[model samples]
Target: MRIRSVVDVKTSLGESPVWDVEQQRLYWVDSMDGRVFRAAADGTGLETWDVRRKIGSLALTANGDGAVVALDDGLYRFDFAADRVELLAAPEKDVPSNRLNDGKADSRGRFVVGSMDTLEASPSGRLYRLDPDGSLHVLDDGITCSNGPCWSPDESTFYFADTWTGDIWAYDYDIATGNATNRRVFATVDTADGGACDGMTVDADGFLWQAHVYGGKIHRYAPDGTLDRTLDMPVRKVTSVMFGGVDLDVLFVTSMARPPLPRFPEDGPQRGALFAVDGLGVHGLPAHRFGA
Candidate 1:
């Protein structure tokens, strides 16, 4: 499928493309700048909210009241109407050297986020799950960088990627309990191929679409871990992807820009821009929201 720029925004780190189905808008984050962006399907009505700290990720609340966001230390509740952000938890308050990274809400409505060393010095990252009642649970540890995290359309599989390890892992997910087990490697790609998987989403037919940060492309893989197709992008640092638009048939993508150097020196000015892939003949399931 051909991916073309839908939004002119070029962020230092653009990630987390989530569709607000009811509002008919797209929400995403610029991680390095701690900015949350919202825009209509046609790319107009673009508005930005700067939280003044590095924001890792965010999920819409089930009631559509606000969002639960992962900043430097922990999760917070961001009320768009009031322009307020209240702390939900500071799980890593003691680890000032670490910062939260990619996160998403599970089918059970729990926010699952991961952490990474800010300096990229050691493999000290960790994965956490924030429940509806504001309790945080540590699911795994010792990750260098956390990136992709998405549940299968059937809610039976959980997938995550450790960017530094160049491996994507899958788990047998218990949707009712928010438990992940039977952890196994699902796919592996070298840095030379992509520099690791960044973010992902599953299609209605059970295929996974993954963004490749270093490769300037998006890879579509069957649930069995076989590559089905690839969509070449104009930028190298493709960060995340989600299906949006009226029928959930448009694939919305985000990317990151490399300072001083154009992220897509060969491809010209489309680097770090948001994209929309249409006419792919596939739709996606709705994103799950945080219960609280």
Candidate 2:
């Protein structure tokens, strides 16, 4: 299928694109710019909130009252109506080089977030579970760039990526106990500079759609880790992707403008543009906000 450019956000580091079905808007973050953006499904009504701290990822709460934001150092609740930010947890205050990266809420409404070093130094990032009562549980440790924590459609399996390793790992999840096990390699890419898999989503068909950063494409793989399809992108650093739009058929992609190599050209039309591709009538699960 062909992908189309929906909007030009020109975000320096656009990442974590999530579709809020109830509001008919797409919420995403510009990491380097430190801005949170909400745009209509049709790419209009583009409004931005100037968050002073770097936002890693965001998820709508179960009750739909506000959103849970993965900030630079901690998790916070963001009230859309009031436009306010409140702290939830600060697990790594001592580690100045580490910051929250990608996070999402599980089916049970628990926020799962991961951290990484801003300088990409050592593999010290770890994944944590933020309970409803504000308790943090460390799920895994020794990760370099915690990427995706998307769950399977059945909620029985969880997928995660370590960007520096180019390996996507799968874990069996217990929704009741908030536990993960069976950590196995799900997929791997060859290009070392692709930055591994950044963000991902599980389709209704039980397939995983992953954005290959620096690889310039989104890879669709079957539940058993078989390559199904690849959606080409114009930019080299694709940060994340999610299925949005009215019918959940539009696959929205977020990209970054940063290049690790100094020789890469900076000026390009596709760098910070949001892309949409038809997923052949496939639909996605609506994102659940923290609380109404």
- For candidate 1, the per-residue lDDT at 195 reads 52
- Screening candidate 2 with a backbone cut-off below 3 angstroms (N, C-alpha, C), the clashing residue pairs are 60-288, 60-289, 60-290, 61-289, 61-290, 62-289, 62-290, 63-291, 63-292
What's the TM-score of every candidate structure? 0.94, 0.94
Query: Which lDDT tens digits does candidate 2 get at residues 110-173?
Result: 8888999887667888999888878889999998789878988988998999887878899999
* Model 2 quality (TM-score): 0.94
Report the C-alpha displacement of residue 92, candidate 2, in angstroms. 0.5
Q: Please report how far candidate 1 places residue 5 from its true position, in Å.
A: 1.1
